[model samples]
Target chain A: MYLAKIHITHKASILDPQGEAIKNALHRLDYQDVSNITAGKYFETTLTSDSKEQAEATTRSICESLLANQNMETFLFTVEKVED
Target chain B: MYLAKIHITHKASILDPQGEAIKNALHRLDYQDVSNITAGKYFETTLTSDSKEQAEATTRSICESLLANQNMETFLFTVEKVED
Candidate 1:
């Protein structure tokens, strides 16, 4: 089996309120040095694929169709073998 | 500097609509054998510190105060030395 890890993030030009909120909270928590904490979505999937090409193709299609809003968000994924 | 990688996921018992949508999309993308896609949030923080304890404490405080919603989501993080 293969594991696909995906991340979706808003375009750099977009303002992310969730990220801003987290950044402010980090300061309150004493992490005063942290800045620009952009929050993004992560997804992990188990796939019954044997080849990296197949996994990538499948994951890309998924991202384009439903995993991300292509106009507003962009996504990237990594595929790896599941170790027993 | 240190790198903090944080992942926040909805409690396992909660129904994840985003995850379900991704699962369906994966199948349509020809990954018929894939299942159970869980979606979460990822945060990467660069700390201005040299001590592990300080990093951990700061990250934890950030999570508790703003990075995560304790009632609905839980988080885990890893700290690593950033390579120049």
Candidate 2:
């Protein structure tokens, strides 16, 4: 088995309103040192695969097909071997 | 400056309906090897701080105050120095 850890985040050019709102909220709560915030999604998935390469390919396909919006977001993931 | 990468995830005992939904969707898309999925939130935050320890403390406080719900979610974070 393999465990894939994925992070899907907005592209640098995209404006993240949710992140902006959170930054504003933190400021209101007195975390004045905060400068910038980018909020995104994280996922941990377990896959039964024969090899590391296959596991990675499956993870990338999954991210591209369903987890991320290619127009506005990009995803990065790492697959690691695990005992199952 | 320091960059803090934070992940907020549901506790093991908590039920995650969104994750279940995504798992089912992947199955429908022919990803039969996929077994378990857990979804969470990720944040990349920049803070102006003099030291790594201070940045970490600030990040933890921010997470506790607004980023995470203590009742059901747990958070993990890492702070690193960054060029400003």
Candidate 3:
């Protein structure tokens, strides 16, 4: 079995309201140097596959159909062997 | 300036319905090897500080106050120097 770490972030062109809110809050707190911050979702998924290629393919499918909104977000994943 | 990547995951004792749903979906798709998955939130924050220590401290305060739910989730952060 393999475990996949998926990181999803908004496309550079997309507007991220959540990130903006956090940014504003930071400024209010006097952290004036902070900028260009973005917030997104992280997923840890488990794959039931003996082959690395198969696991990767399965993870990709999940990310596309369920995990991410392709029009607004971009996702990347890394697969690792699960230790016994 | 520095960028921090924050990851928030449910504590081991918590029940994660989202992760459970995903796990069931994988099983329905015939991916039987998947198990023990948990979903989480990710944040990328920018800190306006000249010193690493100050930046880290600010990040911790943010995480504690507005980012993660201390009772149910655990958080970790990685700080890096942003390139011009």
Candidate 4:
């Protein structure tokens, strides 16, 4: 088995409303320290596969096909072996 | 400025419907390679802070107070100084 720790975020050019909302809210709460924020999805995936290479490939496929929008978002993940 | 990468995930005891749905979808698409997934939020936050210590502290506070649901979700983030 393998564990994939994935991080997905909007492209730098995109405007992230959720991140902006949180930033604005922090400012309202007197936390003017926070300036910029980009929010996205993180997935901790476990694959019951044979090899690390196969697990990594499947993870990338999932991220590209369903997890992220290629036009506006991007993703990176680390696949690690899970000791049974 | 400092960049904080935050990852939030549900507790192991929790049953994540979203993750399950995605897993089912992958199976239907014939990508039965995926077995388990725990989905959560990932945030790329840029904060204008003076010191690394301050940045780390603020990041933790944000994660604890606003980012993660303490009841069901747990969060971890890395704070790195950004080059101007």
Q: Estimated TM-score per prediction? A: 0.77, 0.99, 0.91, 0.94
DockQ for model 1? 0.59
For residues B10-34, write the lDDT of model 2, one tens digit per residue.
Answer: 9999999999999999999999888
B1-84, model 4: which lDDT tens digit per residue?
A: 899989899998988999999889888877876888888999888888899899999999988889899999989899998886
Candidate 1's TM-score reads: 0.77
Candidate 4 stretches with Cα past 4 Å from truth are none
In CAPRI terms, model 2 is classed as high
Off by over 4 Å in 3: B29-31
| TM-score (2 decimals) of chain A in model 3 | 0.93
How is the predicted docking of candidate 4 categorized under the CAPRI scheme? high
Q: Pick the candidate with the highest TM-score.
A: 2
Q: After superposition, how far is residue A27 of candidate 4 from its true place, in Å?
A: 0.7
Task: State how far residue B43 of model 3 sits from its true place (Å).
Answer: 0.7
Candidate 1 local accuracy as lDDT? 0.80
lDDT (Cα, tens digit) per residue for candidate 3, span B1-84? 788999999998999999899788867876676665689999998777788888898888888888889999999999888774
Across B1-84, the per-residue lDDT of candidate 1 in tens digits comes to 788889899988888898888777667766686766898998877777658778788788788877788988899999877763
Two-way lDDT contest, 1 vs 3, winner:
3
Itemize residue pairs with steric clashes in candidate 1: none
For candidate 1, give the lDDT of residue B69.
87
DockQ of 3: 0.69
Q: Which stretches of candidate 2 lie over 4 Å from their true place?
A: none
Q: Candidate 2 has what TM-score?
A: 0.99
Cα displacement (angstroms), candidate 1, residue A59, comes to 1.0
Best first by TM-score, ranked: 2, 4, 3, 1
